[model samples]
Target: MWVEVLGWIIVIVLFAVGMAGTIYPILPGAVAIYAAFFVYGFMISFSPFGWVFWTLQTLIVALLFIADHAVNAWGVKRFGGSKASIVGSTIGLIIGPFVIPAFGLIIGPFAGAVLGELYARSSLEQSLKVGFGSLVGLFTSVVAKIVLQLLMIVLFIIWLLV
Candidate 1:
């Protein structure tokens, strides 16, 4: 009984942290969530949700990981940004949080995209447009991640209850 209780506690904590990680770039949010779920299911011997369900959830996590990058790149390309701009945006994402805390995440990509466009000989207006596009893409990605994460949680709940 004590071991089971401890497991639940750990799972809950991991789920909470994992959800938070989805928003922050530094943490592996999806992976954490998946881990928590995996642990719980393993503890129960996958009684409620079997291998098929587990596999589905795993695929969702994998897709989320890929989608993050694909969507970001799609946004850059959709906004008329060149390869250089995409590279710059990626760099900014990595450097932003460390440089300026919360706001850095938002500003870093925009600035990076603009600089990249400029480097590619784009006019100031065009560079700004690309930057704006990158920002929009980032926002879209966040929304998608949040929704997907919620879905994952809801699925877990349903499986547990059923």
Candidate 2:
């Protein structure tokens, strides 16, 4: 009984963190939730988490990765940004957090997109539009991840209970 209680606690905490990771990239997001479900299944009985569960979870994870990049690139392109803008946005996303704390995440992508567009010889106004598009993509990605993450958690819980 005690072990089961502890397991529940662990699962809940991980789920919370995992969901948080949707927007706060450092947390773990989909992977964390997937891991949590696995751990819980192991602790209880892997029999409940059969191939179907695995397949669905795996697919969702794959989609998460694909959507993350695709959406971002789409945002850039939608705003008339070039390949450079996409590349720059990616670079900024990687380096922004290290250079600036709270705001770096937002600034990095925007600046990167703008700089990338500028490099491509786009006008300043166009560059700004690309930067804004990058931000839209970021937010959209976050929302999508959050929904998918939630779906994963709910699926696990349903399976566990059923």
Q: Using TM-score as the measure, which candidate wins?
A: 2
Clash pairs (backbone) in predicted model 2: none
lDDT of 2 by residue, 97-155 (tens): 77998897899999999999999999999999999999999888988998999999889
Tens digits of lDDT, candidate 1, 1-162: 776787788788878877787667787788888888867866654688887778778888888888888787787889899999998887887788889897978888888988999999999998999999888888888888888877888888898888
Off by over 4 Å in 1: 42-45
What TM-score does structure 2 among the candidates reach?
Answer: 0.93
- Estimate the lDDT of model 1: 0.83
What RMSD does each model have against the real structure? 1.5, 1.4
